[model samples]
Target: MARARRTATRWWRWRRSPLRRRIDVAEAWVLLGAWLLAVAGGLLAGLLTTGTVERDLDRQRSERRESPAVVTTDAVAAADQAPVKQIGARSVWATVRWSTPDGSAHTGRTRVPPGTRAGTTITVWTDQRGRLVDEPLSGADAWLRAAIAGVLVAAGAGGAVWVGGRLVRVRLDRQRLRQWGEEWDRIGTQWGRKTG
Candidate 1:
């Protein structure tokens, strides 16, 4: 079958044949090494990136806590703040006050629903010292983010190896072409001529 010939041709570099140049054997080894590097480097980079990102997110979640705060100013509609399109309930910046675990009061500006009046209690996230902070992602969300980062890093590593291998192969092909061209030039001029 045609497949049998194709299989044999694939291993031609290892066979004894005048057509097999040193560069051909070297190209085979280069390709093999490139594929191996891509696999090994991709796995290492992916695991390292995923672990670092997940650990950082986990640390953020552990250091932040939720608390209720009282808004001291009326919130304006988001439309009034800007002309940009917004989805869901309109929100605005309003000053809020909350107490720390040590009974110390702290105030900061945070986003609240439009039309919210003074003295309305709203849930907020804070650091250990009661400073207003953004909420952290849950474990599942963190894992998902890490997975995406890992995949991108893995793909990048593999792509770099593939590109490097292609460049090497192109250079080798040019060398072989030049060699053939030189031989053909010498042979073309000697047609039907005898030299002793």
Candidate 2:
């Protein structure tokens, strides 16, 4: 039993050498960098993309607010009332009847995405030019945007994790190779000798 214990201890000690440790450390750093970079890139990309979308939406909103138009909201009663029809993905084209500031109503066609659904209350703005626009987002709309953003963030996190794992694996392999080299050197002089 004592001899067996000694053998096990010897084996364990041989497995962990300085070269192996160095390789392990180096590999760790590589993976750490990969993970950090992936995370940073993902965050930056998400921020830029989402920000761009928000800015465009905001610009359109402001334009609608500034125009000499009227804003009105009503529930879409049926298919006839559907100002925009869901045709292609996020593409809707329809004509809608909306009110004006002078207590007058006009019917005009508007093109929007398919996100607007039947039975949803939509706000419409019409200018003196007879150009009609709709408020695409409401309180629930903001929440939905946030949810989409959250999904993008999650995807970024996943990318980071994947990169980190790859880096860790690379480091482990380097460590093993370094350890093997050092072990070989140590055993070279005493090759075929039973002592080592």
Which candidate has the top score in TM-score? 1
The residue pairs that clash in candidate 1, if any, are none
Q: Enumerate clash totals for all models, in the order shown.
A: 0, 3
> What's the TM-score of each model vs. the native?
0.82, 0.44
Candidate 1 local distance difference test against the native: 0.87
Error of 1 at 46 (Å): 0.9
Q: How many backbone clashes does candidate 2 have?
A: 3
How well does candidate 1 score on lDDT at residue 7? 42
TM-score of 1: 0.82
**Model 2: runs farther than 4 Å from truth?**
1-19, 38-50, 65-134, 150-154, 157-161, 164-168, 171-190, 193-196
Q: Give lDDT tens digits, candidate 1, residues 81-193.
A: 65664666567788899988889999998988878888999999999878888899988999999999999999999889988998999999999899899989999899858
lDDT of model 2 at residue 88? 41
